[model samples]
Target chain A: MFPKMDALGMAGAVPRAPQQERSRVTRARLLEATVECLVEQGWSGTTTTLVATRAGVSRGAQLHHYPTKAALVMAAVAHLADRRATEIRAEAQALPTGPDRLDRVVDMLAAAFTGPLFVAALEVWVAARTDAELRGALVPLEARVGREMHRLTAELLGADERRPGVREAVQATLDLLRGLGVANLLTDDSARRATLLAAWKQQLKGIVNS
Target chain B: MFPKMDALGMAGAVPRAPQQERSRVTRARLLEATVECLVEQGWSGTTTTLVATRAGVSRGAQLHHYPTKAALVMAAVAHLADRRATEIRAEAQALPTGPDRLDRVVDMLAAAFTGPLFVAALEVWVAARTDAELRGALVPLEARVGREMHRLTAELLGADERRPGVREAVQATLDLLRGLGVANLLTDDSARRATLLAAWKQQLKGIVNS
Candidate 1:
């Protein structure tokens, strides 16, 4: 049980180690639940209560950490970005310097756009467009995610990213992959996605090798 | 003044022509208003009463045509598709059949993605992900729009429609442009968009010319 804030409300209060650990665990659970709700139910169905229920945390605890739903979702977005950055690095380190690595890297980029991570982020992006308070929180977080993704993308491509205009071309490729991800939302057409991926991989080779 | 439905609600009731035309005009206005609202206010701010007022139609008239907001928005998606199809044809004809044509065509495609049409559609798409009835109405309309856009894109490019990989390449270009459009929503960075366009144009030339 949390004591009254007045007990710990001093200007420079320091919580005990056990309390800090409990708070961290509760926050992580809430963020993960938010992602789950977004992917399965989208923005309209994702609420603070639902997130708290799914995380098995009391509403009081949820509100204590994130007073507003926007705060909770914004924190979740930051959490997702951190996970994606770690993912990109892991994928890059796992890949070798050869044609097979290129194929694998391209696949990695494709998955990043179309997989659960992108879907979860997309729900927030859509909701933010209409919600002013959310947009205020999301814009800075989005920029950081974009920068992290760009760096990881370059690392994945290795020497291919060094040439002039290569960055632009690769950026375009990622953008298109995202578009394809959106398209897939309604149609679920794997064949077209595959065809586009093959064509883009070839295009990337031309841009980088040139 | 319209009478209650029970008065003329028999199994096979016939509405007169002038009334039908008036209804048509009212529906068109409402659809157009929905797009304007989406671009300016996004989904959260859009509602039936606001659309009816914006369209200058009576609330009764609005309810008579589309009983639910989902129905109204779904119809708007179809309306948007028709407008895009018309825009593509007009742009293709306005463009000359030469080198400059390719440049203009690419620019036109880029605008189609980043312009009001795409943004309006995006609002509906985002809203639909969480709304089942809306999703059911949206999927078919989206497919029809996708097909119409593809045909016009082939014509705009002035190329054979039967090529093996050409469709994939062109689709990828459109998709990438759309992704750029989404990115622009937050950052509003025209310079980055232009650079991506130039890079994508080169990539397309390689894909199609091959």
Candidate 2:
């Protein structure tokens, strides 16, 4: 009886029937292609044609998924951010709360920023600055990341946003992380990365203790 | 004798060949134009042609001065860095050694990173990552900034580079400053800047005391 022709069975039987699955595949392809193009040609050099060619899709098909380059870039940035957030969150959760939390955060941040996906996303951000439309799309993502940092810091420091030095610590930490991101992109020095991470841990410990 | 050779015969004398003052006017004009274009069109948008147009100079004139877009951007970065180094040095010299030195260093670093010129230079740096040629040219400038930072931190802490945590502190502080530069660019929140600066100072103090 062919497994009772239900939506699940039919969907499984016909691989191309489900719109959601097809959409997911298209989105994945688009993101993978975006990253590839970004790493190969950088943000300024990556074009729709290049992404389409890399993705093995028609330009029209690519457009159907991401109507504009800005849109595609934004999607890529979000994709990267989402993955990083998950990774950081997991690391933060695994660490014991006090000083260890700070270490975990710094290590996680350094690793995340230097990771290939994040590097590609950062390229998009650089590209987005020259693009007003893309910048507009990126603002919310920036805010979201900031908010996450604020939340994480608040949790780690046992202070609210209104606490005397909580805001400063959070901001400084974020800045440190951002600078390290740039450093990683510029230099391939693991020792430098380790030194930076250690310093961040030490600094965060000071902030927490003080 | 014809009234002493027409009153000392000084009438036709070329006015002491006016010491051809090496005017930095052209350089200043280029830097100003670069900033304007960067702010208007971003790093990628500020091409040599666009910068020349903005500076009201011919392409030949621009090339004669800068030669390459990377050269122009790097010149702007160096100009900004020089100004910052001068400002920090002045502030550091004004302070009596002890804790005041550290305070002034932190203050200067915070202020410098958050300033407009630094922000513009950062935008150029983001663009530099994509252009290997520009990145190569700019790395030394970045290293110089880092070296200056390490020197300042060492002096402030009265510690050598080989000191237990001096290198880490220096690296971390620089990373913090870099992150702050990006944060300031992304948002127009003065309050956040002040908070971040205070936190940075406190953190530095803790490290020194520790």
Candidate 3:
């Protein structure tokens, strides 16, 4: 029923508050659905329709929020990066100081690979390689992750960014972890993953001590 | 017109040897063209028609050799791995044993990232993430590369697989290199690249000396 009312009654008549909350909830649902689709179909097959259907919303509503599939994908990527940054910061902080720090960093880094979010990130990366627009959008996220990684490793090693071999080792370690992510995804071997992680920590320790 | 000839003369008339040589040349040309296509258009965009046109061969002839696009991409990836193996072996042998080994390894590893072959391989890797067939074909190649890296690092560090920390560090360094490749492909900062390489070597030194 529609109503004509005075000031206090008119304020209640406005549905803006509930509408805003519903919009926020729908947006979050869509983003989460996008991640699930990425994990299932990768970047190549993650259509907007799939994301909308997964989110239990109509295609029109999905488009109303995201405008385009690229925008949706970009938003999903940012959501993932924010989540990962929090995990990394928390894990890095939990590590014991001195020699034990190396073990903690290695464990945390290795743990990052076992989740679906990282897999989605890899899909985004592959998508970015060919899409200039996606690449442009991804640069800030990549830089932020890289800077965080450098900071985390430096803190763990008790070395500054300028310390000899710190940057190189950090970069190399990130590469190895990325490669391992691909490897772990392709195969079903946990032992090999463990071996790789252990070998990485040893190398990191060597770098820090040297 | 058909020519009537004796059996011995007919055998000579076939020109089998020259035809085989020509086929080999055509195959090589096709592979070179495939690499070019991959570098220009990425794995998803590269097609048999495009590769045939780039190689200046008929589409029929290209298919006669490669049979499928997957076969062509696999061939390109294999050729890349072989070339990298040769370079790594040569670089490793050229370096004097001990601390000098790390420098030589970095130089060779650097070459792997700065070239067309690595770029092509990166495309193959991206393609493999979604295509089960491509992933199946790439597993052995990835394993071979990993083994080669392991062997080279073991030699450089004078550590065996039994030393878990040494192996872990080596693997982590490799991950960093892989991550750096992604970064380098996306960015144009040479100074940052240099810093990454320097840090890698310093990390290696620490691992080796320890």
Model 1 chain A, poorest ten-residue lDDT window?
A: A4-13
Two-chain DockQ for each candidate model: 0.50, 0.45, 0.40
Comparison by DockQ, 2 against 3, better one = 2
Model 2 clash pairs are: A175-B179
> lDDT by residue for model 3 over A45-128, one digit each (tens)?
899999999999888899999988788987887766666766677667766777777777766776676578788877777667
Total colliding residue pairs, candidate 1: 1
Q: Can you list the residue pairs that collide in candidate 1?
A: A176-B176
Which segments of candidate 1 are over 4 A away from where they belong? A1-16, A159-162, B1-20
Q: Interface RMSD of the predictions, in order shown?
A: 1.5, 2.4, 2.8
Candidate topping lDDT: 1
- Expressed as tens digits, the lDDT of each residue in A75-134 for candidate 1 is 988987787776677667877887767677888887778777788888788778767888
Question: For residue A180, what is the lDDT in candidate 2?
Answer: 76
Per-residue lDDT tens digits for candidate 1, residues B125-194, read: 8777777778888888888788878878877887564787788777876787778778877657688888
The window of 10 residues in a row where model 2 chain B has the poorest summed lDDT is B2-11
- The residue-by-residue lDDT of candidate 3 on B118-180, one tens digit each, is 778777776776789989988887787778766775665566646536666666556656666
Output DockQ, candidate 2. 0.45
Local distance difference test, each candidate: 0.78, 0.69, 0.72
lDDT tens digits, residue span A34-89, model 2: 98778767777889888988888888889999988888877876765665666566
Docking class of 3: acceptable
TM-score of chain A of each: 0.87, 0.77, 0.78
